[model samples]
Target: MSDKLTKQSIEETFRELSNWGRWGEEDEVGTLNNVRPEDIVAAAGLIRRGKVFGLGVPLDQPLQSVPHKRWNTIHTFMQDGADVATGMFEGRLQYADDAINLPTHSSTHWDALAHVFNDGRMYNGHDARRFGSKGFPVNGIEKMANRMVGRGVLLDVARFKGVDSLEDEYAITNAELDACAAAQGVEIRAGDFVLIRTGYQERFWSRGDWAGHTTGMAPGLHFESCYWLKEKDVAAVAADNYAVEARPAEGEGFSYPWHGVVIPAMGLTMGEMFYLRELAADCAQDGVYEFFFCAPPLNLPGGSGSPINPQAIK
Candidate 1:
């Protein structure tokens, strides 16, 4: 087997990028340890004009175009005016109640450290078998809820390249990342929640092209860009694409190699399918890409991931 596919080489890659034992033997939050107390204070200080942007797509909309096993969000009304009219509630107070059942990753969401595995192992070298029908016993999404608030930096790569959307399967290299940051006049700092805008979400919004945006080729971070994130000590990295990395897997006989390294090896949480159109526009207009960001995942114990409505305040 080639070095890229060989077991020994993959192990070496894990060792090189792993954040295991960084905080402790029993650590679950992974790179979130980088977000110190001072980091939160600094992120809060970035709030100026009080402009807030919600970086999540509506979950009510059905995404039937993506050729995937995951189903769209299904919202059901448990109690409504009809029930009140039917005298279901004897009390004078009338209320509407509803429930939703959907995949945890059905929309904009954060993937926990246990969301991916490598060689039957999870983040911090936990056994992948620990996660089953009961959900992740360790490295659950609940462990990350408190550390989700931090400094946010937007790297608008599509705007930097003068394109509305990058071509399909376009891999954004570290060089481009650096160039985009430089052009935006923002420096990527440790413990910052870095949001990359590839303009992929805009395609669906403008052309109603869900098939092309979801199942077709998409642009995103290059496989090697995980090293760049490691070097910067970023707390979390998100993108306006289905997957955070470029589609049509760069590695042969492998799918989402970036997920393998970042989630299992590096223990880095990733946000996918985020809505960054409004935030990117504001960043470009004001020339201010730094903001106070917060996105607390649901305190779902044993969950491998959770949907989030991330907010960016500037």
Candidate 2:
């Protein structure tokens, strides 16, 4: 590996790992196509204990730590008790109504294929210029609503390494992922949603360090793991971190180099900021790292991403 990755290396990796024509020319769902109906049925069979885990943090918490100065969820009431008391409604059947304003990525969410790009193209060679204030015209978050249900494989890397959380900027390599799965006695299979628990979120919860969890240095997948993910044919990859790839990025001339290859080039969807503490505890107790994973984003047309409360049933 070169200390400073050149532009040509990035371009070559994009060309080599691309899933451009794998599904179809106009495909929007990307690697989610790997999840067949039978895979969903098999995932359902893993729910023996009937214990469910909600994988999203409360959206109302202020996320001032996030990048680009993104604001957290704002819940405002259109009609409330005060309004009712004021006799705002003419009809006797008065009801409370409310609405929420939030950036989709402000909480636990899935990044649509159009959320990132390489050069001037998105997934399946869609022009990046197609996105604007109207949002993505192609490969929008709506296209992934039905494609999110399937088997989920949990690789608790932090627990495997005997740490509460991985050190900052620690990149989990392909070999580490393999070793973690082997230690947990779990198999990484095609069409599975692989969740890597780095315990970064747990650290944030325990310390009340939102800035450290969000904008500060972090641990995540290595750039080389993109090839490993492609080889496994997983439907998606998620983690308990801001970006799924390590921060202070490995490449000298690049930022978020893993995102360049995975999202746009390989057409792989990604989930971020998942709350996996309890789920990891349960998996550790039962020694069962596989579960029925289901998370469907809101069907918003032209959305770049959508907040999700992913569920893991065991």
Candidate 3:
């Protein structure tokens, strides 16, 4: 906390709390080491109601163009013709396919440890030179694909604050997170996929104002939450917001400090732009806050991040 929100503080925290050598000097999977195979077995016990909810935002064609330089995904829909050509498949075997081209940090995506770098260093002190102009030479998103499965706990901050969704520029603090946990009667344990819902995206969906949602001010995670997350030893943290941290940033002359610290420093992957309204509603209706959370990133080798189709089973 001495370094506070400055780049100096981020460096200090990385030196103090990094899992760089805990796994290995050659380790690419950072805090994902906290996720054990047995964690999945125990997570299955949370499936009493046998309900499943997807967390991916629907990626449709000609996605909304937003300000601040972060636009929606581009999905080109296509189909196989019923008329057969030379060397074509047999009749009645036509299908559909879509080619998607977007930023790796697209809707409902996972930010790999290499997503951010500091001073020519990546997670665990890996050299940024390892990252080629094409993609990551190490610590790729594929390394995290299988490692991102485990228990998920939702802290619905909007509901806790007596609002359908929090106002723009609201940054969630550790105290607010604690209050949500207390209200749900759940203790955040190690190896949990801690998901915080700000309810911003869903409200935008109702009004069809993705432009306003994406370009305008919004809620996000407090930088202090990074320290709390590292202390708690969670496998990863995800959110319903785009950057997962508030903007314009709380730190003076520092923008998106937590992304630099948490992904590159703490070695934790962050999920963003999730569709958590249904899951939040389900949890509230049944009063079950924790669930079997399972989300494996797409196996794109050398990818810094991947669009993920996450799910919560309860």
Considering TM-score, where higher is better, how would the candidates rank from best to worst?
2, 1, 3
Cα lDDT tens digits, model 2, 1-314, are: 22656778788898999999999898998899999999999999999999999999888755457556667788999889998899988989889999998988888999999888777789998889856898887999999988899999999999999999998889899999999999999999999999999988787788776764567788888888999999999999999988988886755446778888899999999999998999999999989999999999999999989999999999
Model 1 segments beyond 4 Å from truth?
1-11, 64-67
Error of 2 at 275 (Å): 0.6
TM-score of 2: 0.95
Error of 3 at 284 (Å): 0.6
Stronger candidate by lDDT (1 vs 2): 2
Q: Looking at candidate 1, what is the lDDT of residue 25?
A: 92
lDDT of 1 at 220: 93
Runs with alpha carbons beyond 4 Å of true place in candidate 3: 1-4, 61-64, 67-71, 77-93, 250-253
Q: How do all models score by TM-score?
A: 0.95, 0.95, 0.90
Clashing pairs in 1: none
- lDDT of every model, 2 decimals: 0.87, 0.89, 0.80
lDDT of 1 by residue, 243-308 (tens): 989886545435777887899988899999999999999888999999999999999998989999
